[model samples]
Target: WFISYALDEYFYFGIFYGMILVFSFYNLIMFIAIRQKQYLYYVLYNLSVGFFEMSTDGIAYQYLWPNAPEWNQVAYAFALCATSIFALLFTRELLFVKAKAPRLNQLIIGVIVIRLIFFIYCYLFNQTLFSFKFIEAIPLSVAFFTGIYIYKNGYQPARFFVLGYSFLFAGFTLKFLIMLGISWLNFGVVSYYSLSFCFVLEMVFLSFAIGDKVRLLKLKKDKAQQKIIKQMAINAKLKDTVNQELETKVEERTREVYHKSLIIESKNQALEEANSLLQKQAEEISRMNVLLEQDNEELQTSVEKVSRDRVMNTEVDFEEFSKIYPDKESCYGFLAELKWSKGYHCRKCNNDHYFSGHILHSRRCSKCGYEESVTTYTIFHNTRIPINKAFYMIFLIYSSKGKISSHKLSELLSIRQSTCWTFGSRIKKVMDERKKTLKKTGKNGWS
Candidate 1:
């Protein structure tokens, strides 16, 4: 029975130490990779705890330090001191005990100091019982309270810390009970594996707590980010609404300003029209005075032949006439302008109102329905020849220095002698009528 138990103890210690070494190296590499002090402390604590357990099981004597039996005696105490120091620091960092549980943090520091003092005293006296008792009462107690305090305060990972450490404390308690000869709870050979299993479970639970903390933090960050985004969207919507309202107000004000400007512009136009009318009246009065003065001078210079002439030679030559009246439309437009210089007036009905005739460029009196041509009552009236030729004939007759006979005028104008004579007679009659009209008005007919 003793041989089987010893073999089980050895096998279990190897497995337990191997598992702890793996955990320790993993955390050590993690510390190196991430540069977190907590991971480094955790690795040291795991290694020291494993060493203490191995020494208690006599594994250090069997394998590690067979040549140095005295090392076997002192190794457990040294390992205990190292484990307590590193574990205190690791728990402090992991749980942020200094900030969250300052009283408990101070208690842990006191425990570590007491353990260190006890370790030195035990090393000198060659005793280990007081150190073990100190660990059970103070450091473990402080760790438990710190876990509870942090857990109660809503630290998310503290629950795992409590659970993991509870298992470790229970393992220590079980081993202590067995040492006091608690036979039934020891479970014979199985007791050799119990502590190792508890330690493995503790490490697993602590790792789980770390993972849970990361998950919770990430969830909180994501929720906060979502809230910020939602707020931004609301703010953007509010900004857009404000901008739209401002734009509407601006547009309404702009329209009001535009309406006021239009009123001002209309008033300015009315003022301008009144000023133009006054200016034109002033100019007309001045022109009439000038014309009356010029009339006396023209009467002195007038001759019968010059007064009877239909065309003024100085007013326009053939070159100018061709330019001014290039086509039938040009001649018609000029005659229309001259005829209606004072506005359209019907000769037959003596009405100022007229409508356009169906015939090209003719007007009919609105009251009498009498049609009028642009050429009516003018020199080219009742013309048998093209109006352009008639104009040339008149021009040639009036523009000549000496009297132009019908035969010579016909050859020059490319018309028959009879036609030329008739045209000339008609022109002469019109001229006589104009001369009589001018005399009746008591105004000189030429200048």
Candidate 2:
């Protein structure tokens, strides 16, 4: 196979194998660093696919095992079996087929087991047992369909898987057609170079698929954490609000209680003071009542003394006044005695003779024919108050110790204050004149 191909082609194949080795070893290290099963599956899938391509293209025969040409006969078949097993396992892990696509997972397992059995049979029997072309097509096709199904169901990483498998499927179909002597699709490019290019694309696409899966997982985790943090913030704010409201309510209640307590204390103080004042007032009222009773006894004794002192004079109490001046005629008779203490005499003729006038309570002089009234030349002359009231006023004036106000005099006499003032002033003026005359005439000319 090397004798037919050019030296440039060998160089190209070497570079392609170097790339595959780099991808394989890098992913294997990633599996060790991260300890993820998907990384391990990717590493194994890359190694098995690269080995199958090399064995089919006669590269392994020339460089890897030159001394054992007989090994070439079964190398491609064994590599194919290994490739199928790892590819299916990687697909199962990548798409989460065991959980999400269980039927697909079972089908892949069955294919892997059947291929392993066939590989073992080929190894033991030393025969080219069955055509390995359809066996090779089965796993690639299943992986492609699985990518489509999972991608349709919204798996974001499956698009890369589908694209990577499409390239591998194309390579496998072309190689199969060439083995059956259909070489028109090769179109001047060697089948091995085409297969190498397709293998490189498959590796890149599969690596992107794994990277995409990681990115999506990280995005989901970050979103869930953000949601939890936001919820915690909301709860904390609600707690703060509740605490603030509780504090405000507490302050209000405290103020209200304090105000009410002040009002109650003031009221209690006022009530206590009022009770003390009432007790003092009760004691003072009791003393005043005793004094009032003593005053009444003294007033009665003074009245009896004044009555006894009036033995030679006319008494002016109610009984004495009624006996002396029971009617108008008796009142005139008393006024006549006070007016003229001496015998009646004529004013013009100086004759000491009198006769009764035709009018009642009037006297006429017979010597000069002059008439006179019993009230003439007395304070009762021209009085608007009744004669009885005039006598009472005179008695009250003489008995009172202090000067009485007109209001008190009017209240006692049951007369108007104006009338009491007029009568009292007139009587006081008359008594003052009489006192002056007595001083000048030695009290003898008053009569």
Candidate 3:
């Protein structure tokens, strides 16, 4: 009978302790992977429970402390103290009780300090009091209550935390009853390892709690990224609408310029007919010829001045300026022509062959696959302002002889005062560099 009982005891204790070690090792690896302190504390708590089980079963005395018989009396007490402390620490970190429930967090800290003081007193004065392991019910109950309170306040992860603690709470309650002289409730083998079973259940659920928290945080991050993408799409649509409106204005201006040319051509034809008819009246035709020549000269000079002024003049209204640039497409078209008018050559490989690039009015080298935007080397590179607006701002600053205030420029461009000032200052510096050229080249110097 003694031999048979020893075999059963070894088998059951071996299996239970093996499971505890496995849980401890697995959580230690989790702590390494995530660097979360809660996992480390959980591993410690599991090891404490395993140690307490070993000491109570006399396995620690036989295997761990074989030379020291005196430690067997208080070994379980030390293990219980570690278990309660580590469990409280794990609860504090896992549930974020500090942030959610500051008062409850302080209470948990106080409980830990009191539990330590009692353990020290018991260690120094009377080690026999260490057998009253039911005192653990206090710290365990504190952890359980904190989980419930945090879960009630809408912390989703706390649901699993509370569930995990409920099992441990039940196991502790049963042990507390057994300590209160309820011998009939202890059902042999099942009752002996009930707490071990509860520890495993709690370990599994606490893992679920950590996973649930990570999932919730990922969902929130994804939502914020989606909002940013949607706003970018809306901004692109607004820019396209502005381009379309500018294109419509350009079409209207083209029609007006064509009509004016047709009127000038008809007047020239009328003058030729009059010259032919009055040829016999030489004096009269001579005087008429001089007058006609003067009128034509005045009209031609006026037309040239107006066209050039609108292109590079402060006096030119924004409405007139839109006819020249009109839209981002038109601005990009001008930049593309100016940048690569000579020939297409790869800056990276010096290859001449290329393809149209992903960006509008950009080119990509076929050899090196190096793509270059039209504005890459220009002043407009990396600028967030619309290309057309940047062009208009430049013309305004140049025509105003760098005298325009940032506030006035901001009002006209419908841009921020700081932005206008920054861009305007850069334009002034460029104008200063080309001041001599500007005098010789007139309005075309901007190009």
Q: Judged by lDDT, which candidate is best?
A: 3
Error of 2 at 133 (Å): 3.2
lDDT of 1: 0.74
Model 3 worst lDDT window (10 residues): 305-314
Best by TM-score: 3
> All candidates' lDDT scores?
0.74, 0.76, 0.83
The order by descending TM-score is 3, 2, 1
Instruction: Write the number of the candidate with greater TM-score, choosing between 2 and 3.
Output: 3
Better of 1 and 3 by lDDT: 3
On residues 123-215, what C-alpha lDDT tens digit does candidate 2 reach at each position? Answer: 888456745566678878888899999999999899999999899788878877877788677676656466678888999999999999989
Tens digit per residue, CA lDDT, model 3, 1-447 = 999988987887788788788888988998997788988998998899888888987889988999888888888899999999999999999889899999999999999999999999999998888977778889999999999999999999999999998998888787778778899989886777778778878888987887898789889878766765676587588667765765676577567656655755665666577786645555554565576567657756755665555444557777667666667777898889988899989989999999999888899999999999999978898888888899989888877778889999999989999999998888888788788676776644443
By lDDT rank, best first, the candidates go 3, 2, 1
TM-score of 3: 0.57
- Kindly list the per-residue Cα lDDT of model 1 for residues 298-367, writing each as its tens digit: 5434433343442254455555565444456556766788888899887776899989885557789999
Pairs with backbone N, CA or C atoms under 3 Å apart (clashes), candidate 2: none
Cα-based RMSD of the predictions, in order?
Answer: 42.8, 57.5, 12.2
